[model samples]
Target chain A: MPDTVATGPGPAPSGTALRELTFGEAIREALAEEMRRDPRVVLLGEDVAEAGTPFKVVKGLVEEFGKDRVVDTPISEAGFTGLAVGAAMTGLRPIVDIMFGDFLALIMDQVVNQAAKIHYMSGGKWKVPMVIRATMGATRRSAAQHSQSLHAWPSHVPGLKVAIPSTPYDAKGLLKAAIRDDNPIVFFEDKISYAKVKGPVPDEDYVIPLGVADIKREGRDITLVATSSMVQVALGAAAMLEEIGINAEVVDPRTTWPLDEKTLIESVRKTSRCIVVDEGYYRYGITGEIASVIAEGAFYDLDGPVRRIGARHVPVPFSPPLEDATVPTERDLFTMARQMCNK
Target chain B: MATAPNPATTGVEAGTPLRMYRQMIAIRLFEERVNDLYTRALMPGLAHLYIGEEAVAVGICEALRADDYITSTHRGHGHCLAKGAAPHLMFAELLGKEAGYCKGKGGSMHIADPATGNLGANAIVGGGAALATGAAYASKVLGQGRVAVCFFGEGALGQGVLYESMNLAQLWKLPVIYACENNLYNEYTHYSETTAGDPVARPAAFGLPAETVDGQDVRAVHAAASRMVERARRGDGPGFLLLNTYRFRGHHVGDIAREYYRPKHEEQHWMAERDPVALHAAWLVSEGLADQAMLDRIEKEVAAEMDAAVEFAQNAPYPDPQRVDEDVYA
Candidate 1:
C-alpha cells in the first residue's frame, strides 16, 4: 500500500528540514541528505564543485562530501550523463545537473533512449537509479539557447520520472525522493525560483513521494493546476479570484510523469472548472497533456470547458518586455479563471 | 602500460577444445540462417549480420560465465547465441514473436534475455558501452564476481559517450571489459575515411590499458578476453581490447552491393581467407577434438532449431494495444 501520510499530510517530520530556504538551498539540502544516508550516492555536473553549481544549488557539497563524491566533469552533457547512467547501473545513485535545461538536447540519446528504456528493454534485470537536475525558465534574459522549460520533452519519454518543483518545500522533498527512486528521474528547477521562493522545510530527511499533487489552496469555484514557476502565478491568480468571490483551488503536481491525476480530477469535480498554467509554449505542450487527460477521464464531471494558459507559440525572446509577453502571467491565469467561473 | 603482446600467445590454453568449436559453428550457422530469413522477408525490422566476425563474439563469450553480463551492438545475434541465448528464442525474436525475449516489442536490433545475463542489444551506435560499464559496477556492488563485456564496432570509438564511459570505468576501477570489434567499416564508409587516427590510441590516451588483437583467431580472442575479464573481476579496473576483424556483409540486410565502396578483390580476400569460424573449426579438427561429420551434425541441429523458432514466431500473437502503456513505469 502507498504511504498514507504522503497523500494525507500536514508535513513529513522524519526528513531533513530547511527553514526559509531559497530554492537553491533546498536542493542542496536534499542532495546532502541523500548522500549522507546512502554511501552509494554521488553528485556530478560541470561546475558542481567548489565553484558551486551554475545556480549555486550544489554550494558547499564538495567541501562536505569531498571531491570523489561531488564530481565536477568536463563540459560534455552527453558524455557525463552517460557516465552517470553507468555509475547508477553499477550501484551508485548519481544526482547529475545539466546546468541549463536547454542543453538536454545534447544528450537526448543518453536520457531518452538509454536511461529511460534500459530497465524494460533489459526485462527488469537492471534499474538506473539516477537524478538529473536542470534549471529551466527564462530568467535574466538567458534567451533561447540558455533558458527553456523543457520538462515536456522528458515527460514524453517513457521510463523516466519527471519532476518540476515550484517551491523550497517541494524542491527539497522532490529532490530527495528522486535521489532514492529506483527509476531515472529528471528534476527541472525553474531559474526564476532559485532565490525567490522560500518556505518551511523540516530539518530531518524525508521524501515527498512522486505522483502526488499538493493542493496549495482549497476552494470550490475552479481548480488551477500549475507546475514550477507557473505554480506561483496560479496562486497569485487564485488570491485575486477570492476577492471577486471565485474561490479557486490551486494544485501543484510536483512530479509531472507519474502524475497525481486522481487529486486533480477530484479538485476539478468539486470546482466544475479547471485552468492549467504552463511556462512552455502552448501547442503540444505539457498543458495540452494535462488537459487531454482530464478531458478523457473526467469530462462528464466538468461544468465548464478546461482552459490552458501557457507561453505563446514563439521562441523565448531576449528583450525583457517580449520575454515577459511570451510566458504566461498572473493576468492570463486570472482572466482564464474568471472566464471559467463566469461560464 | 605493459607492452602489447600477441593475442594468440597471451590467452590460449594448450589446445583448442571441441566445445569452443561447437560455439563458433553455432554462431556462424545461426547468423547465416538469420541472414537468409531476413532476405526471405520472414524476419521483421533490419538485421545486421555478424557473418564474417564470428571469432570476436565466440572468443570473448567463451571467456565469460553464464552469469556474467554482455551488452551487444545491433549486429548482436552472434553475441546472443555465443552468450547462451536459446537459438529458438533468438530466431523467434527476429521473427517478432511472443516467445522471443522482450516479447516481440524488441525485434532484431533489440533482443535481450537477462536470465542468461545478455543485457539486450542497442540499435544506437556506441550506446551500450556505458550500460555495460554500469552492469559491471552493479556486479561489484552486489558482491557478484561477475564481469561485463561491451561489444561495439570501430565506429563507436569516435562517440564521446564511449570516451566518457571509459574514463569512469578506469577511474572507479569498475569490472568492465570493453571489446572493440574493429571491423574496418562503418556502413559503406571505410575507417580510414571517418576515423582521424588509430582507435586503440584513444583509449590508451584516457589511461586505460589497451591492446590490439587479431579478431579472426578464436583462440587469440578467448585468451585476451579471459585475461581482461580476470583483471576486472579482481578489481584491477577496465581493459580495452581492440579486435582487428572484418564484416563481410553490408552494414545491414538489404544493403546494395558496395563494390563502389571497396575493391572487389579485397572483399574476396576477407571472405575466403579470414573466415573465423572455418579457421577455428579446422584447428579443432586438426588437433583431434572433432571431425567433419561432427561439424555437419552441429550445423543440421542448429538449422532445425532455427526452423522451429520461425514456426513459433509465425504462430505467436501480437501484444494487445492496451498493454502499450504497461511496463513504462517501474
Candidate 2:
C-alpha cells in the first residue's frame, strides 16, 4: 500500500500520497467546493436534498446552499434533464444526479435529442453548461437493471462530453471542471469506487481540465489503458506484473468522449505493446474505439496485436459470483498483460 | 354569421399592424416555398409544414419582445420566421447546407436562431414544455422580466413532461406560457383518440389559469397571447392557452399518401373553408384596411424574397468533412 495521508490540518507536504475516502465523500467535496466558488452553480436530483442524496455525494449541499440551489426533484429524468439543459442554456450551471445510470435509457430523448444537440443545433448561440452525475457498477445485488455501465451510449453522441472518475482526487477536480464547463457533460461514478477508493483532494477550489489523461504508474515494457473503476484494477494488475519482470505503464483517461488520444498513442508508441481494460461489454465498447485509434494512428510502433480486456457480452447477473465473473477483474488484466509481454 | 368586434376599435390598439402583417405574410410564404421545395426534391428530409398554422406563430410572436424566449415544435418554420430567423438560413437548413442553423447537422426538424431569441425547434414531442419552464425559472432567478413561450401540440398533453413542467411552473411561479396548438391530430391518430380529457383541463388541474382561443383567427390568438404574456411579465406564474386549429396538410410533406387516417372531406373542409391566411386576407380587405392590388404586391414581393432564399440555399457550401468533430464541446 502507498503512504496514506489525512486530508485535514497537518504538515501536508505533498509529493505522492494515497488517501482513503469513499467515492461518495470525494463527489460531495467536489460539489461543495464548486458551489462555494461559483454562485451560478446549483444541484438537482431525486433525493439529493434532505434525503442526503441517493449516493450521499450531495449530503450537506441542501443545508449549505438551501433548497433553492440544492433541489430535490420528482422522479422525472426527462423533465428535470430538459429543465437542467434550459437552465444551463440561460447561464445557470446545473449539476443533475440520476440515481442509477440505467435510468439514462429512459431519458435518452432529453440527453441525446435535446441537451446534446442544443449548442450545435442553435448554431453556437447557446451552450448547455450542465453535468449529469450517476452511479454505475454492480453492487448490493441491485440486479440487471441498476448495475449496468451504459456510458457508451452517451459517448456515441456528439456535443456531449463524458467523464468517469475513479479516485477521490479525480472526483473533486473533474466535478469542479464539469460544473464550470460551458458544454454539456455526463459524469459517471462507479458504485464500487464510491466506498473502495480514496485519495488526497485539495480543500481549495481546483479543476482538472477535460481531455487529459493521468499516468497511474510509469513503466516501459507495456502500456495499460483503463478508465473509471477499471483504472484501479489496472493499477492492481500492474503491481502484480512488476514481480514477473514485465513493467506496465497504466493510463486512466478521466474523460471518455473527447478522449486523450495523444497521451494514449504516445505511451503506446514507446512501449510497443498495449492492453485496454474496461468494464463495459467487448463489442462496440470504449476498448474497441481505443484499439482502432491506436491501430490506425500508431500502426508502425506496434510490435503485436493490441489486446483488449472487458466484460463479456452478457447481462449483469444478480448473483455476486456471476456478476464478479461478468466484469473484468484485476486478474484478467494481469493475464492479458502477461500474454502480450510474452509475445 | 356574426361578425367579431374589430380589435382596433377595442381601445387595446393592436400592435404595429404593418409589422404583424409582414410577419404573417413572411410565415405564409416561407411555408409555401418549403412545401414547393419539398415537392421539387430540392429540400432533404421530412418537413412538417406550418402552412395553415401561420396565425398561431404570428400572433404569439407579436406578443413577445426581441429579448423574450420561445420553444418551438417540429412544425417550426413559421415560429422561426415569426421570431425573426433569416429566411435564407432557414432555407439553407432545409436544403442541408453549411449555411443552415445547425450547419446542416439538423435539418427541418431542428432549426434554431438564438440571436432572435428563438430556442432550437425540438424534434421530440412535448420536449420544449419543460425547457421553457426552466428558462422561465432562470428569468426569475436573474430578475430579467422576460417570459418564455412553449409551442407544443394537443398530442403533447399525453407527455408526462408537460404535466411536470406545468406543476413546477405554477409551484415556483415561473414566467412561462404553455401554448398548445391543438390541431386535433398527433400524426395519423386524432388528438381525441390519444388525449383522455380536455387539453385545457390538464393544465388547469395543475392550478394554472387556462383559456381556449380561436387559433384560426390571428386577432383572437394575438389578444389571448397578449393577456397571457402580460400576466407572465407581471410575475403571475404560468398560463396555458389551447388554440383550436387544424393542419391543412398531412403531418409531413410525404405524409399525403397516409390519407387513409382522415377523410378527404375533412382535409378539404379545413383547407378550403377554414384557411387561416385566406380568412385573414378577407378580413383585412373587407375591413378597408388593405386593397386587392396591395395584397397582390405583397404576395409578389414575398415570392421574390423566397426565391432569393432558395437560390442562396442551393449555392451554400457543404460543411468540411475534416471538421466534423468540431463544436462537440465549447
Judged by TM-score, which candidate is best?
2
The digit string of per-residue lDDT tens for model 2 on B1-330 reads 101112221221326544456567777878888889889987778889888888898888888887788899999888888777788988898888888888887788888766777777988899898888888888887889989999998878888888888888888889999999988889899877888867777888989999899898888898899999999999999999989888888899888775678888888899898877788888888988777876767667777888888899989998888867666667
Q: Could you tell me every candidate's TM-score relative to the true structure? A: 0.87, 0.90
Query: TM-scores for chain B, in order?
Result: 0.92, 0.94
lDDT for A260 in candidate 1 is 91
Model 1's lDDT to the true fold? 0.80
Q: Compared with the real two-chain complex, what DockQ does model 1 have?
A: 0.40
DockQ of predictions, in order shown: 0.40, 0.56
Runs in model 1 with CA error above 4 Å? A1-19, A62-66, A203-205, A296-305, A336-343, B1-16, B65-67, B136-146, B170-175, B230-236, B256-264, B288-322
Q: Write the per-residue lDDT of candidate 2 for residues A118-218, one digit (tens) a residue.
A: 88776576788999987788745888898888888899998889998777777777888888889889999898777667666655556788889888787
RMSD of each predicted structure: 5.8, 4.7
lDDT string for model 1 (A1-343, tens) is 1111011122656454435677777888888888889989888789989989767878899989998788887776887787678668657888888999999998899999989997776545567899999888984697878878889999999899999988788888888889889999999998878777766777766688998889988888888999988887887888888889889898988888999989888888888888898887788898999998777767998986788988888888899998888888888888877877773
